[model samples]
Target: MDRTESKHVFVIGLDDFNLAELQTVRNADEYEFHGLVDYDTMVHPPSYPMDAILAEARETLANAPAVDAIIGHWDFPTTSMLPILRREWGLPTPSLESVLYCENKYWNRLAGQEAVPECTPAFQGLDPYSDDPVGDLNMAYPFWLKPSVAFSSYLGFRIDDEQQYLQAMATIRDNIHVFAEPFDNILQYSANRAALPDHGSGATCIAEGLISGRLCTLEGYVHKGEVVVYAIVDSLRASNNVSFFSYQYPSHLPVGVRNRMISYADTILRHIGMDQSPFNMEFFWDEATDRLWLLEINPRISKSHCPIFQIATGASHHEVAIDIALGRKPNFPRNEGRFPIAGKFMPRVFGDTVVTRVPSREGIETLQKQHPELVVHVAVNEGDRLSTLRAQDSYSYEIADIFIGADSESALHDKFRHIMEVLDFRFSDVVPTNYN
Candidate 1:
């Protein structure tokens, strides 16, 4: 393809690190790329003018040549923003209502109940702004609570007692509306949004029964209303908290379990009317009962797993997102990459602490030298407070992301364990003092 004539794609939230993986797409040579928003703005935009960011997104795209496609793999704003822009420019993408069916937690559960009740857990939406926020909930204590629109499990909490519930409500009251207001503003433009359960602009949240089992994600895309699953990635969490420790592609799940998950996802995606986009759906499988529970369905590829897919399968799943964006059928690879298995591991600290030290780029380089297949990315600097990291989950702080490949699952974990020891992350406890 000639450079001047290449198709122009505006990737809403492309980050520097993931660019390499996108370059390996089979259609890479046929397109040119432009990035619209950095990660921070995409995650949490300034609140003074909720629609200002969307205006800027429109302006940015307008300045470019006719955009062949608008694509993104980030959740929230990206998923929301993509459909909005597509509608504006008369481009092809999933409808905003379809995306919302996957985003709005309360509505998503409602749709899931109708389409896959066997996989849906008991849930109820709560208005955090109410005088008695806890009173509106039908679910009991020990249930999980989270906002209707959030990313990376930002405000999610597991409530065990009234004290914890009260504490969580207080936090939600102060923070939940930030994303909600903007999401509601976007919904105003959707002709199909009115029929869905009104989530009141995302300020509200949901409390659901806890479903525990082996966690994994199905990565795929819908083309012309057909749901196709390309891969499954195991989401391994830290022993004590909800933060993910690693994501391994070519899940080690039994074939029977994997098949059922794919089937369940197909029914739900089709029922909700999601098409012409990449999707990531999480599920939990109970071994003893042999049941699969739906966690949540996200309307984008899991960007964190892109590199691992490339390392283990020759190409990243970004190919699917890109292909679908351009209105072409995706041609995904199978058993094509260097390693049999690959993982993206997170090294986290579970408490509030001040960073005293972290590995330098040079130090990471040395470790990568030792382990030729390793790629280390540190998110903190010396003297930076861990709590100040933007978009961090309330319970834990991730200091670094380690990507690696191995011949087997056990070897992949062993490699991650060895790398964690080599990368030094030192923190000093922050003495708590009431500031109010």
Candidate 2:
């Protein structure tokens, strides 16, 4: 842990906020972190520019004194690109095929069905560009349709009828390339990717039987041959059940259900050959039927939950990712922090609107001072036009994110309400959304 012997780590799409998190990691002085690619350009950009990002990262790697680890917290192309970079450099990380098992929805479902059929949903792949996509699909109305390789619920839709299915397909065809092109680029790197189903490419979509219940996520990582799950977060949704409302740490689910999720996570991670990597797997427990369903598996830390984990635990889960990336065992913390509860609230305005007003930097600073355990990140500026919000779900636009820690759940919500009321946000030219 000497300063002179500190190792160098490269992070894809690194930003100021995450850099601050990395600094608080245990033994922070033992590593020197470098940003591999521009955050804005890498995430929700007009184009992925995969080649450009790889070339830029290579240039940085070549200049570094020594590369100890390569880590990233964002979704694809960050998650998809991690294995490729690590494999090329002989770094310790999951294989490309294993990472793809978690990224490709169809492939992940196949693995889930094999490993834990009880928790896996019935699904089938459908080529959105096919002459008879619906004809090939067997699911009835009220099923879910989405890209095989998507993030943040982009292009995800619940099909209640034929008209809705057609509309969703048209929209998918239009925007699918934004993710498909770059995702395919990474797919090509997989040695056995050709063996996958023809319709399992990034451009494809999956039809899933309607599965709903208590939504929760287990954040964990695999190292060497062992799988470890550290925390479970409950995902709350708005009334529409389309957009996420907030992510609260320390799930309130029954102990038995949480254990099944953990056991399934371990099974799936081992079956998919995931190792030396971090993952956050989501699950749904159907209370009515006393059934459990595997939602989706992501092959990396959920950056959205990092702050909440930090508030509930003493350190951020980034430490687990960093450690695993370095080919070392993770020294992660459990419920050892100040607060018994923490939550991340995503305040969304479900339409396109021009930003007329937002809280000033001074005002935010004052609020933070008043509430020590509070953190607010406003996503828009005063004069900014809200033409497109690519990082959000298809149904709504998340204008700001608020993270807070409190002794009780009610207090956590109380803080969020006070912040929303005090920090006024005004918009113009609003297009009201109808989540029907």
- Candidate 2 runs further than 4 Å off: 193-199, 334-336, 383-387, 429-436
lDDT tens digits by residue: candidate 2, 147-208:
98888888899999998999999999888898888988887888776545455778878889
lDDT of every model, 2 decimals: 0.83, 0.85
- Candidate 1 residues lying further than 4 Å off, grouped into runs, are 45-50, 198-200, 429-436
Cα RMSDs, all models: 3.5, 2.4
Best-fitting candidate, scored by lDDT = 2
lDDT of 1 by residue, 24-47 (tens): 777688888788866667755555
- Candidate 2 global TM-score: 0.95
Q: Candidate 1: lDDT of 320?
A: 87
Q: Alpha-carbon error at 13 in model 2, in Å?
A: 0.6
